[model samples]
Target: MNTQPLDDAGGPTAGELGEHAVIEAIVAAAPSSSNGDDAAVLTHAAPNSQVVATTDMLVEGRHFRRDWSTPEEVGKKAIVQNFADIEAMGARAVAALLAVSVPAETPVSFFERLAAGIESRVAEYSAELVGGDVVSGDQLVISVTAIGSLGGNLPSLRLDRARVGQRVVAHGKIGWSAAGMALLERFGRENVPEDLTEVVAAHCAPYLTPGRGVVARATGATSMTDSSDGLVVDLTTIAARSGVSVDLFAEAIAPGPELVRAGEVLGVDPWQWVLTGGEDHTLVATTANDVPSGFREIGRVGKQSGDPAVTVDGAAPHYHGGWVSF
Candidate 1:
């Protein structure tokens, strides 16, 4: 493998540098044996820890757009989403392998910036960058597989553990990302209101706080999930899996000013976004005991009595659940 050659501006196009060069650059910061290897070797930090793995893919037009998302933003979003999956299981992210398929004309600088973003986010959790493959494709496709470690003493949070009489609590903002997407779709990036800047950024690059799942586990949470697929959808999954129903209190979930402003601009009910928005990836857990600090009680669990698995104040949600790839 060769290092990417720099242009006059110290940035090179992948077309100019070739495949081997770009691969070498991406693995430069990787902690594993990325160079000159068919596969990277991994060793558990603790003998008793169990490994948890998850994979996600992002396509150019389906998941993101170049005009709206920078290379760094794309990188961070990819890593965070996969990492959130690990955290949702009550584990600590330990390593990641990234694979990318891009057109030959893609710029080497794009990969460089993307690797930097991945490296920075991985470092935030003291995780390693492992090895992955590079391939040629018609358009950009990025896939990330994240590995996590669960301490032998801690129990993994699962969807089927939810039971009646448990409280449904969530930490972090909900519906912000969907609201941001609404803004971007209704009005172009240039026309987005200044008040909605935070939500817009949340959509482009939402922050994932590590260890919140562990906190839920410590607080005796019986069931947990990441709200990546919208609150109603994820909650419905838990409800169906556990044979329990979740009733969300609308009064408990007061819409923020940003969502309100977004609803006003879009001429739609803000509560719809709150219930059905996806990509927020916030931590939602059902606990029989008090919720841990930093999490608020949103609703309660009960025996399933009817067809609808998740409801808002005893009523079905007005809108459908979050993003669907197909």
Candidate 2:
């Protein structure tokens, strides 16, 4: 591994650094100490605890564009989306393995910054980077596998646990990421307004409050999921799985001032983002008891009864847009 510092031009390409050097540089930048190892040993879990795992993949042109986001931002986004899934299950992240495939021409500095970003975000939670593999490919692809612990005596939150008469609650920002994406598409990053910079930042790397699932679980949450797809899409999933219906209050989940201002600028309805935008990584859960401090009541559960699985103010939503892998 070359220990030489990168200059403004990003120093060397991955081909020049070689696979071993690239992996060494990445591990050096991150929190893992598993050098020259085929596998990493995970920490032991407490008795009666359950482990949850999830994997997500990001592609260069499809999921992210290098010109639109810095390598650090892409790295942070990768970690957040995967970890959010763990939290959605009412578990805390403990470890993660990152696998990266990049063209031989890709810059080594790109991965260094990316590893720094992963290390920074993982440091926020009690987790480690562990070990992974790197390979040369035609394009850049990042895959992360995250492992979490549902602490002793704690039950995992499930989509099927939601029932009729429970309150639908949410914590964390909704629609901000979509608004930021819109801003970037419309005005470009440099031309975006000073006040809306945060919105743009959200799209790059969404911020999720740590331990939200544990808090919701402690407060008697019935079911939980992260709004990775969209408010309506994820809630509809919960409704279908639980064999119930969700009635959302439009006012309760209305776009905030930033979204409203963004809508006016883009001539797009703010509700479009609020109801259909994805990647906010907001936590939405159902509770029969009190709503926790960090969460707000956005809707309620009801009988499915041949109606739409999810609705807004007792009517079908006008916008049915959300992310679809296909």
Q: How close is candidate 2 to the true structure, as a TM-score?
A: 0.95
Which digits, one per residue and each the tens of the lDDT, describe model 1 over residues 126-224? 887788888888888999999998886767999999999999999888999888888877765656788887887788777877788778888789888
Q: What local lDDT does model 1 show for residue 160? A: 97
lDDT of 1: 0.82
Which runs in model 1 stand beyond 4 Å of their true positions? 1-11, 29-36
Q: What is the C-alpha lDDT of each candidate?
A: 0.82, 0.86
List where candidate 2 sits over 4 angstroms from the true fold: 1-8, 34-36
Maximum-TM-score candidate: 2
Q: Give TM per candidate.
A: 0.92, 0.95
- Residue range with the least summed lDDT across 10 consecutive positions in model 1: 1-10
- Every candidate's CA RMSD: 4.6, 3.9
lDDT of 2 at 153: 68
lDDT of 2: 0.86
